[model samples]
Target chain A: MERVLFKPLSQVAICGGTHGNELCGVYMLKELPRDRSGTFSLTTVLANPRAVDTCQRFTEKDLNRCFTDTLLSDLLTEDSPYEVRRAQELNALLGPKGSEATMDLVCDLHSTTSNMAICIITHLNDRVGQHLFKYMREKIRSAPVRLILLTSPLSEGYSLDCLGKHSCTIEVGPQPHGVLRADVYNQMREAVDRMLEWIESFNSGTVFEGGEVEGYSMVEKKDYPRDPETQELTAVIHPQLQDNDFCLLKPGDPVFMTFSGETIHYEGDELYPFFVNEGAYYEKNTAFVLGQKQSLLVPSISVEKEQ
Target chain B: MERVLFKPLSQVAICGGTHGNELCGVYMLKELPRDRSGTFSLTTVLANPRAVDTCQRFTEKDLNRCFTDTLLSDLLTEDSPYEVRRAQELNALLGPKGSEATMDLVCDLHSTTSNMAICIITHLNDRVGQHLFKYMREKIRSAPVRLILLTSPLSEGYSLDCLGKHSCTIEVGPQPHGVLRADVYNQMREAVDRMLEWIESFNSGTVFEGGEVEGYSMVEKKDYPRDPETQELTAVIHPQLQDNDFCLLKPGDPVFMTFSGETIHYEGDELYPFFVNEGAYYEKNTAFVLGQKQSLLVPSISVEKEQ
Candidate 1:
């Protein structure tokens, strides 16, 4: 692994409360060092104000899911939901998309009820995102910055970060929606601060030495047990697996428990569960998303543009 | 305290999901033996189906709060939101109000994000409610069914339980809204089953021996610390007081912790806090409510009509 300088970015946007009930990002973004930049412009946004007011995931539709190209193109529809219009407006503000984006870097903030530590979700090939992840892994002390790559099959064009090529999301949690836990709050704040420092260093053409990073690649999501007839939940996450997010779930592990005291075991291959039992994902039938570990030597980003 | 026989009721409704995301009630109600009729008629209703579909507290206004006379009376207004109309419809179905009600008992079920135990909230003078509370106290094994009396000044007429004088609430918690923990779910189901058995005994002219019950009375609610400039939350529940729900708080006990790490101490007389740091209460500025403990000897209800 070689240390190489990365090119300085001209402008970046830091966003929070995209899900509304997630308060850490909103709280942290408000206190960020907006004045610390002589090298680049920093724009902070509270993405969904109406949802935040009601302490909900979204107002009409999920703001995160409303950023699809089709939805953004149909922004003029009079019957469009609140989040559709918001996506179009945000796209215009930070992005025109692809190369025309005003934001050279986009850092969207989110929190989960999962015990994921300083999670950084981005495209697998995103160089800038990888650089940021490496910086946080080396810099942040409280917890490891776990990088999870969203593979090609997972639709990326429907999220705020998709508006820009050099974008990443900061996801930290185990904090319930609309509730602020001091431990998680501080962890999230530190994540944002470290991320900002990483951006600042990149903008200043500081070299980020390449290092080995341990992370997971998202596979697929699994739904909890539901009644075959009514489709309502028939079982709950087992007591053993309840708060064991990000832990390796091997075959035969107890996964769910029926009301009558029947325990259901995991019959699948070993996988790590993240975002276990997130309240926001209840409607989606998501008990948790499985991830597979990958050990990689992150390459340094060179400041020079290849001719 | 000597147990006396309570009058048999003709009909009862066990309701759940009033807040939609509270799953224990909805899940428990689904499996209840609705056909059993050796005693009173048992009707199970999932209160806010739309909110449950979306895994939120409500669509427009809180369904629980929408039961007020003004909203129920104004159900014909096109301006009335989903929950308002739902409230009016619910009142019409389970209630007509007071002594004219067809349903002898309306047990509204709820779950909180707070660490509240199996809580029974109702007017202290409601003798039947007190008897049920005493029954739960003696029967349920996990936690004591703590009673909280909503005095007249508290505006009880605004809630679903206010539909009839015989109505009472079964609130259990430490569970987040959308996520169902198996531990909490089982506890809630037990509470509901025990309640039904208590009702059946009353209906069968079975004498309930009077017994002493331990519970609390609501004193007042306290809001969390907010920034003077933005009115946004500036503090969180102190680590020491976070999960200490139903536990006594002395004058010098820390209740809140500022973002800057400052601890705010309780300054009032010794009172227990319930529903501490409930995520749903954030919008209402409710950090938690204060409760003073009370020990009461519940009297047996005689089935005989004295006239």
Candidate 2:
């Protein structure tokens, strides 16, 4: 095999089972061949090792929520919770405060119980990220790819993806915690390989060329209807909307079904609902998030120019 | 609709999540219509309410293991672990120990990460249990049904199934904890409904006519190949055996493949493997269990004859 030599690039893959029950990402990172020859330097990490070992969501706090700026500095204590200290260690490894990131790009792998497609979560302002998303949408035909830009203010510095200059978190689902499906595993493995190949192509001066991406922009998270007194869930995902995630939810469409067999129609304007009935979000009472579809413009990206 | 009527029978279904992460049984029981008219009186109880709420396998000790005779004695105290106390409560509710079982039948629902199909686990001597298993095996065609006899000496009086005179726990899988698959859930629902219908027929003087049930009798558990020093898994299920669960593993068949691409052949006789790579059994270092095929004799079971 002829080696393709190109400009040096440093990329890292940060995978979390930090919620611990998510086994797809953990196993993917663990099973990845440690050493692979490529133009770009690649490093793989298990973001929450302890949680992965225990196969729980987290030991004390949700590790995904511990990456805020305040929690990063001066709050470090010897007796701090596992996730807080792990976040600080991750910061130093992937991103040191007030310093250039050691990694040029980060790929965080995640799995969910929602019927959402393979999602590429990146900031709206990231040009390179958008181009990569378009590439993956075309390159990985086994699974559909969607781009979701986090619009919440609190999401700014709270996730592992924010630790790098350019990052794309891959979310695949309709799977539960601690279970690995061969089909799902194969899809995820192919994704990691495709991602690495894309990075290699980028460093080797090959543009992703032309492609179109259809994605949803973050709008709002809608919680399930609950009773005021006991706060018990009063309704479930309506039969029409159940497993029909990412479909248009126009006004008058059945969105919820009350325990008493009454259907609640969507009262809002047309939008697409994703993350329908996600198991992890049950504690937060979230039924799903509604988003509006928009065509994403993919800008040409060059690795050497960025470097 | 003509309703079948006959001798009255009290049958209680004890669904365990008592460890809580197993949601199939919990949801099946919860979603089952509260009032169904039948000859057999039905009562359903969530074995481990607290564990079910937390979606964990268990809060303290394994709830299934805490049902031993010693733990059921007067030694249980307020300071005892959560499951120990929970076991005592269940005893009063289901068994009221050292007396006749409070219920005629129990159906403990369980899920596993293994590729095992719908399994009916019961003691070897239960004539009525075998009849029900044979009926389910023939009726529930969506998934194959297997009968597993808990031949272990310690298996007696240590599980919720022991709380009833005629009980067979339904084990369905290849699902993760806290997640529910529509297919798996539907299968379980149908099984529960079928079991109830079978019980009704038995009580109404209808004999489950004829069916030969090909079942695998428990032989032994086989663990994965692990590193002698660090005890890390050194190989994965071989390609030949992956998803080939419940098939006979003849001598010299491929069973595992080492990380270095070496094949480790199976040296055992023609025994069948089930529960391959079950997530819960990882703690026990169990890869799967080997069983020998045997024709289970279905005895004509009538409620009046048993009484």
Candidate 3:
């Protein structure tokens, strides 16, 4: 277990209400106390406040998808989307992303209608993210946890998590918008706490060992079958696939069932699926994303000694 | 069996999309072919077209609840609610409330997030409604079926179903708003077909048996536990009660669980609960409605022979 020496994580942020309708995160923010410890600084943000007020995911544009470097630095006019301006403000606050002055880590919270139990998503090839996901999977005991690595570069990353130097998103689900479950709320609370604890342990001189970690790397997305003429959906998620996220999907397996009582089978290559049958993704026509199994050997690291 | 007779049902209307996000009916309307037969004329309505287009429950006000006589006859200024005008227009087409020219029967379609399987909601004291529900229960074997009797006067009815001479609402659920499932859509389709079949049978002089029918009569509503200071929800539906609609809720049974993981038990009299934990009802602060089991002996009836 060779350790790679690095600077201690001194600046951390926890954000929620990125999607106003997702209540687990929105309410979790209210319960989190502001913290300013001697070792590190903590910032908690309520993202997309107007959307939360109306219980709408977003007013004009989705705030979660507004954090790309291009969008963050873009000039804002009076007619600019509300989320774009909000993203810029966020950049000024915790990000100005890709800069050395940026926050050490940002943990964005989300909830999905899809039965993705507990998903920790991070940027691929980031050694810090890999170590963090491994820690989360080990510490989170109440629910099944899985990590997804996005291959997109940080500058091209669209989610709010990509705004920090080191970042990840915690998505808990089988929960609906504007609705909360005690189990889900508990899951969210524990995740945030565990994340904070990990940061504290790292800053206190605990070394993270290098190891091969297992996760999913997305290959492509699958959209719902729709009527070509009307563009209306012709089928829905198959009974076999619904609520069975992260299951390996094989060719010729039932993926959808048409309104006419016909089963639509999967013809694509075998892959593990996540984000299955999300209600929010209905607007985007995405049924789910297919992923290939991945194993990454993360680098071991430690906080750099002060001075 | 001797039977009281009425005129044959010649004109019937089936309406969908009264609340547009409920997609079971919206798509069902598209699937129905126009019928202009010798025995009966079938008219299928896509109610609230604008709402359906936007995939919202309603643009301003709920269209399903906008069909009361007061709203239908109210003076329509340019500033009136869109649903009000639409209700008036529907009244002119299929109704002029309490008039002999009203449609013979109206089957308004609905879907809910609550696990109320196949709910046939009708006006209390209507023999036609009782007979229809009895018939639907026997015919629809793919799902569980239940009937709810509204105690309100027809004139005071707040739903689109009240616009006809004999009307009932076919509510199927646990379906999310804006998301359609093959199972739910199939249930909706079957319910509509059976209702129309019953209508034709009654019109052709089939005798509906006099018998005791069991159903639910709503007694009161229960709102979610909320923070007294902020009015934000403090607890969510307990896991035991979630998706357990139409179940006996006894005193001391867990109904809610606070975010802090404390169980909130039911303190009221024993009753059956339905429409439990509906997301749409979140806006109204209604967690669920309690009902008392009811038994009504409906009289045998037959369509009066012409002349």
- DockQ scores of the candidates: 0.58, 0.24, 0.53
When 2 and 3 are scored with lDDT, the better candidate is: 3
Best by TM-score: 3
TM-score of each: 0.89, 0.83, 0.95
Candidate 3's chain A scores what TM-score? 0.97
lDDT per residue as tens, model 1, A1-307: 6655444676888889899989888787777776773667888988998888877789889999877767878837778888989988898898866655457778888988776768898777677788788887778888767888876522346788777657789998878788887878878778777777777666666666676777788788999888789787878889888878778999999998987779999988899988888877867879988999987777777565434
Best by lDDT: 3
What lDDT would each prediction earn against the true structure?
0.80, 0.73, 0.85
Best prediction by DockQ: 1
Question: Using lDDT as the measure, what is the rank order of every candidate, best first?
Answer: 3, 1, 2
Per-residue lDDT of model 2, residues B1-307, tens digit only: 2222223356666565755887778766656667888776677788888888777888888888876778877576677998889888888887764356556677789987676768888777666677778888778878888888766432355887777766688988766666555556556777777888787777777755544566677888898888899776666677678667888899999888765457899997899998887767767788778988888655444555445
Give the candidate order by descending DockQ: 1, 3, 2
The clash number for model 3 is: 3
Candidate 3 iRMSD, 1 decimal? 1.7
Instruction: State candidate 2's DockQ.
Output: 0.24
Question: What is candidate 2's TM-score for chain A?
Answer: 0.91
Share of native interface contacts present in candidate 1 = 0.62
